[model samples]
Target chain A: MTKFANILVPVDFGAPSRRGLELAVDLARRNGARLTLLHVFDVPVSYAGMGLSPTELLAPMWDAEQEELDRVLAKVRDEIPEVSRETARGVPWREILAFIEQRRPDLVVMGTHGRHGVPRALLGSVAEKIVRLSPCPVLTVRAEDEA
Target chain B: MKRILAAVDLTSTAHLIIRHAVELARSMGGRVRLLHSVVIAPQVPPPGVFVPLTSFRAHELADAARTAMESLEESIPRELRDGVVVEIGHAADCVCEAARAYDADVVVIGAHDYGLISRALGTTAARIVNRMDRPVFVVRPMPTSHVVEPEPVSAKAG
Candidate 1:
C-alpha cells in the first residue's frame, strides 16, 4: 500500500520554497498527512582579525532570522490553515536531512532554480543537494516551470 | 495520438509516476505505455571441479516484475488499465529506448532522493531526462494521505 505518514517541507521565505509549501500543504490536507514546516537558522560566521564579540555580532542576526521565520510560519498557517511549524539552527542541507532521518518522513517537497555556473557553485543549491542525499522521495518543483 | 511512456522499476516510488502518467493521459487523451525493463541475469562463472556450474536466468526476474504489475493492477483506475505496458531492461536504457521506439510525447518517472552521490552520478530520472528527447515528469510520491484519489465527476444514472 502507498504510505506517507509525514511530509516535510523546508522553507526559505522565498517564492520558490513558498510554492513548494503550498503544494505540500494542499497535498497533506487532502491526504490527511501531518505537514511539518521548517526554517533553518544557519550558524553565524565572522572574519578573524576585524572582530567583534561572537554574541554581539551574531545575536542580532539570530533574533532577526527567528522573527522572519515566525512571520513566515504565521503566514503559512493563515493561508493553509493546517500544518505544524518549527525553527532550527544549522546548515540547511544537513538539518533538513537530520529531520528526515529522525522523523522518517515519507516525502520531502522542495523547490529548485535549476542553477548552473559560478553563482550556483558558490552558494550551492539546497534543493539540488537535498535531492542528492535524502533517503526518502523528494519532489523538486522548478521555479521557472511553475510560472 | 502521441504515445506517453511511464517507466516502472522495482522501486516503491515507481507507482507514483505511473499514477501521474495515467492522470495525464486521461486529461490529454493519449495512448499510454507502461514499460518495466528486467535486467538480463548477469553471466555466471564457469564451474570448478569442486563446484557446480552456475546458470544465469532472466525469466524469474521478469516474473517478479509481472507480479508487481499485477498487484498494482487494481490500484490503477479502470480507464487507464487498457493501455498498461510492461517490459524489462536496465532501468535507464530501457526507459529511453522505449520512449524512442514508441515516439512518446512525454515520459513520467519517480525519483528517490539519493543525496550527493546520485547528484554527481545523476539519478535515473535525471539521466533519462538529459539523454532522452522527451519531457520527463519526476514526481515525488505524495504521502498516501496526500495522494488525491480523483472522485468520479459523473454519477451513474439509476
Candidate 2:
C-alpha cells in the first residue's frame, strides 16, 4: 500500500481545474496529505518585444496574481485549511514539471480540458505534458462529458 | 466508490498498478477489476498471397492474453479482487467500455516512459485520459530509490 504525504494541484481556475481542486481536497483529507495549490503565470510573447523590461512590466501583474490566488485560496481554505499556495512565472508545463522535481510530491492532481485531434496538436495540453513527463503519479480529472 | 478498474498490460509494472488500485479501494471501501486488452494487429497479406494469417495470429494473441489475465486475477488480493476482464480491442477504448460496464468510480493505469516516439504519438495513458469520462489515475513506475532535492526556481519577472 502506497501512502501519499504530499499532493500537488495546479489550477488555471477553469471549471475542470476547479473540479480537480475538489478531488484534491477530498484526497488530501482521506490520506492526510499536504496539499499545495500552484498557479503558473505565462508571460505573453508580445510582452517580450514591448521594449520595456519584462520584469518591470510583470511586477504589478505578479502582485495582482498573488492577490487573485489568495482570493481563490480563501474559498477553499474552509474545506482544506492547511493547504499551501505557490506562484510561478514560466511556460505552464515546464514550471509544473520543475515544481514536481523540486517538491517531489507523491501525486499530482490536475485537470484536462479533453481537447482532441488537430487543436490538441496545435495547442499542446499542459496536463498531457505533465502526465507524460512528471516523475510522480498524475491523476487527471476532465470536465464532465456532454455526450 | 464501489469499483475500480485497473487497466494493465501484463508488464512488470502491472503488479504495482494493481497494488495502487487495490490499496485505494481498500481505503475507500471499493473493489478492483483488473482489465487487460489484447491489441490484434491487422494482418495484410500481399496481393497474390492468400494466406490465412490474420485470424490465426489474432486467435493466438488473444489466447495468450487470456492466460496472462487469468494468472493476474489469481494474484490479486482476495478481498479487493472483484473480477478480471480480458478484452480484444484498442487499449483505451477497452478501458473506457469496461469502466462503463463495471460502473467503476475511477480508472487506474500504469504508464511506461516510451521516450520520444511515445511523446509524439501519445501513450496509452494519454489516450485513455482524453477518451474516458471517468477520472484516470496514471501511476508511473517507481524509481529504485527515493531522492528528493529542491530544483532551482526559474521565475523571471523582469
Candidate 3:
C-alpha cells in the first residue's frame, strides 16, 4: 500500500477549511504523514495603483493576518503535534501551486464551498482552481452536503 | 462504515486509484465498489465516406468495457473487491450515477493534469467533485522514486 508521507492542508479559517483540516489530521495520523498547514495572504493589486506603496499599505493587514494564522496554527498544533505551518503572500491559487511544486506533498486536502449554477460560474472557487492545477492530488471536502 | 466507490479510467493510474480506495476501506472498516465508464464517442462518418449500416457501436463498446471492468475486478484481491460496475455514457455522469445508485460514502477518483486545452475543458474528476454531493478523493500518481524511498527528514522538517 502506498502511504502518504506528507499531507498539505490549506486553511482559510472558514468552516469548510476547518472540515478539511480535520480530515487531513485524520489521514495524517493514520498514515504517519507530516501535516503542513498553509495560509496565503493575497494583497489586492489595486493598492499598487494607489499612491501608497503596496507593501507599506499591506503591512498592517499582513501583521493581523499573521497573528490570526499563528493562533490557528497553535490550535492545530495542539491536535497534531510537530505539524509544520507556512504563510505566503501572493495570489491564493498561484502561491498554493508554487508551494505544491516546491514541497511535492503526496496529497493536498482542502475545502470547497460546493457552489454551482450562475454564482459559481461568476465567482470561480480557489479550491476548484487548485484542484485543476495543483501538482499533486487534492481531496476536496465540501462545507455542506456531507454524505 | 464507509462505502467507497472508486471511479477509474483504466489508465496506468487505475491501479493506484483502486489501491487508495482499498486502503481507505480497510482502514475505515468499509467496502469498496469499482466503477468504470465507457465514453462512447459520437460515431461521425466522414463527410464523403460510404458507411455500412451496422449494429450500434455504442452497445459493442459497452460490452467490451464490461469485459475489461470484469478483468480489472479479477485483478483486485478477492477480499478487497466487493463490487464492479461498468456503465456507458459520460464519465462524470456515470460516476455520479453510480455513487447515488450504490449509496457510496465517498467517491475516489484519479486525476491527470492534462494540457491547457483539456484543462480549459475540465477533467472528469473535476466534474465529479462539482456534481457529486459525497466527498471526492482525487489521487494523482506520485513518481515512483518518491514513493519507493522516503525523503530526508530535514527536507520535510523545513
Candidate 4:
C-alpha cells in the first residue's frame, strides 16, 4: 500500500479553495494522511507602514481571518475532525513553495478559478506556475470540477 | 483476454500509476504492460559550426524504457508479474499506439491536475487522452499509503 504523508493544501477562503480543501480532507481521511491547511497572507502596502502598532492595525484582519479559518474547519470537522492548519505571511507562490520545501508533503492540492478569455490570459495562473516549479506532484482542481 | 497498459516517466508519479494499474489488472484477471517513452530532442548545430549531427540510439532509449518499466513491475504484487510488458517510444504516440496494438481495455495515467488549458493542452497525459482509443484513468498523485482504513472496494472501482 502506497502511503501519502504530509498532504499540504493552500487555501484562499474562496469557494474554489474551499472545494480543494474538501477534496483534500476526504483524501486525508481515507488515507489517514496528516493534513496541513495553509493560508498565505499577501499583505498590502498600507499594512507595511512601521508607524501603526501591530495591534492597532493588524488586529481586525487577524480576527476576521481567524474567524474564517474557524468556519472552514468547522465544516470539515462536521464531516471529518482530523486536520491541522498553518498561516504564512508572504506571496502566495513563494510561500507555498517554501512550505513544501520545509515540510515536503507527498502531494499539494490547490484550486484554480479556471478563468478564461481576458481574465485568464492577462493574469496568467498561479496553478500553472506551481505545476512548473513544485518538486512534489500538485493536484490543481478546477472550481466547477468539485461541484 | 483483458489487457492493462501503464505509462511511466521514471518519476514518483510513475510509481503511483503503476501500482494502480497492477491492482486494476489483478482484479479484472487481465495482463498488464508497462510502457515508457523518451522524448529525444533533435541535436542542434553550435552557433558558428556546421558539424555532422549525431543520431540518437533508439535501442539505448528502448533499454532505458525497459528499465523504467521493470522498476514499476518490481513494486507491484508478484502475482501480476507474468502479465507485465514494457516498451518505450514517443510518450504520447507510444501510449496511444501501444494501447491499440495490445488491445488494451484501459490505460492508466497520472496528471498534475491544473487548469483547463494545462489539462487540455499542456501535458503528455492530455495528449494521450485525446489520441488514445481506450479510456485513460487519470490518477491523482496523492499517495494513499497513509489511509489507515481499509480501501472501500468502490474507491478503486473507477
Q: Which candidate achieves the best lDDT against the true structure? A: 2
Model 2 ranges with Cα > 4 A deviation: A53-57, A116-124, A145-147, B45-64, B114-122, B146-158
> What are the TM-scores, per candidate, against the unseen true structure?
0.58, 0.82, 0.81, 0.54
Stretches > 4 Å off in candidate 3: A53-56, A117-124, A145-147, B44-60, B113-122, B141-158
Native-referenced DockQ of model 4:
0.03
Q: Of the pair 3 and 4, which is ahead by DockQ?
A: 3
> Least accurate stretch of 10 residues (summed lDDT) in model 1 chain B?
B149-158
Q: Considering lDDT, where higher is better, how would the candidates rank from best to worst? A: 2, 3, 4, 1
Task: Write model 4 residue lDDT over A37-63, tens digit each, in one string.
Answer: 888776667667677787777777877
Evaluated on CA atoms against the true complex, candidate 3 attains a DockQ of: 0.35
Evaluate every candidate with DockQ and list the scores: 0.08, 0.36, 0.35, 0.03
Q: What CA RMSD would candidate 3 show? A: 5.9
Superposed by TM-score, candidate 1 places the C-alpha of residue A73 at a distance from the truth, in angstroms, of 1.6
Q: Distance (Å) between predicted and true CA of A129, model 4?
A: 3.6
Worst 10 residues of 4 chain A by lDDT: A115-124
Residues A31-105 of candidate 1 have per-residue lDDT tens digits of 556778888877645434556775887789778877887777777676555677767787888899788878777
Q: Which stretches of candidate 1 lie over 4 Å from their true place?
A: A44-50, A115-124, A145-147, B1-6, B10-75, B79-122, B128-158
Native contact fraction per model: 0.09, 0.55, 0.42, 0.00
Candidate 1 residue-wise lDDT, B1-158, digit = tens? 54667777757756566666665565456655777877764565567644332222456667777777666554556555535455556678888788788877667776653344343424566656445544455555544654455333122101
